[model samples]
Target: MAFTGFGGSTSGTTDFTQELVSATGLAERDRPADLRVWPNPTPDGTFTIDAGEARILGLEVLDASGRLVRSLGALSAAPFTMELGGLGAGSYTVRLLTDRGPAVARLLRQ
Candidate 1:
């Protein structure tokens, strides 16, 4: 399957997938140019999502197995802080459904 990452490009290779990658592979590279995430390898169970001027439509947190962890339905802002303290330490995926499109990011809970 085709995958996008932080750099903004989808390679034909299966090096990545939409399931969520730590830092190397994020989504929205081919869509919204403003959606971003900080502190990829989060020391805590929280991270900030900044979508610039784009309005978020939805948000979801998924595990490596593609299981939905947390679902924040129908977002209505640009910048926000998502808390994942409920999730144990592991790799997770944060999907940002924005007006431009859906953006995926890799998250590491420590």
Candidate 2:
């Protein structure tokens, strides 16, 4: 699937409901790859993002209120480590942009 870009409501805040999509002819449910976040429920706020065979292009971490808290602009690696030590303990959403498509995973900081 080819990820065109971010799209959502016109209210202002970005809605990440449309996780992945196909720009060509593939179906919407056809995901090119799987995005994995390990060490979930992290105690130290450190975790890893693994995109399987897909290469990670960008990464974003959003708070529970849908506010962007952390972002790693453009990247070219996978299975990398990230630390959220500065952020308060709470639930966050992790969004990773990959060559195949966009992958999202829930993260818990403690």
Candidate 3:
């Protein structure tokens, strides 16, 4: 199956679910080669998006329950700095809305 970017249904309801593993036991499609966040676990909210060679237009910070907590909005380019100082220390996931598709990574706030 192909990744449909972010999950949104025609019924007009919340659908934040995602398939962690495809039927083949791997991501349906490959993620950006270098799309990553540096300093996985950061004490401060300051973080950087590596971009690697991809163009990430937007970002969404989700809680462990897959609920969207914050939206970084659309970006003009990649390798940008994100200030999540408002978030509390805990486990979180950063969803990179890239030009190619979506990429998710674990983020820890200190």
Candidate 4:
């Protein structure tokens, strides 16, 4: 995430607190990992999964308490999108079962 600020007409200062906070948060989340997921805290009933060069065998959505909510088998492509229409508002775990290993990510429903 990028932010721009307009210069002041006179001598002034720019508060870096907000920018620092935002940058830290973004950096912590957007790591160069093998897998990625997005649209977390989404209400659109959809989310994406990015499995880099891994053969995805299955996908599972688990509730916050570690209960299995849904399972999908045999994904044929990378960066696949899944629908979460029936899921209620809460935190969830999206597990991508690949041939190499399981890539886990967090998801939030709104």
Winning model by TM-score: 2
Model 2 residue 88 distance off true place after TM-score fit, in angstroms: 1.1
Candidate 2 lDDT by residue in tens digits, 20-84 = 45456666445665888879899999998888887778889999999999999766666789999
Model 2: lDDT equals 0.83
TM-score against native, each model: 0.66, 0.70, 0.64, 0.66
In order, candidate lDDTs are 0.77, 0.83, 0.75, 0.78
What is the Cα root-mean-square deviation between model 3 and the actual structure?
A: 14.5
Q: Which of 3 and 4 is ahead in lDDT?
A: 4
Off by over 4 Å in 4: 1-33
- Ranked by TM-score, the better of candidates 1 and 2 is 2
Best by lDDT: 2
Model 1 lDDT per residue over 14-73, tens place: 444454444444454445737688788888887888877778888899998999999997
Give the Å error, residue 92, model 2: 0.4
Q: Residue 88 error for model 3, in Å?
A: 0.9
Can you tell me which runs of candidate 1 are displaced by over 4 Å? 1-30
RMSD in order of candidates: 14.3, 14.6, 14.5, 11.2
Sort by lDDT, best first.
2, 4, 1, 3
Q: Tens-digit lDDT track for model 4 on 1-110?
A: 44444444455754432233464554543443367888877887688888887878988999989999999998897789888887789999988777666788889888
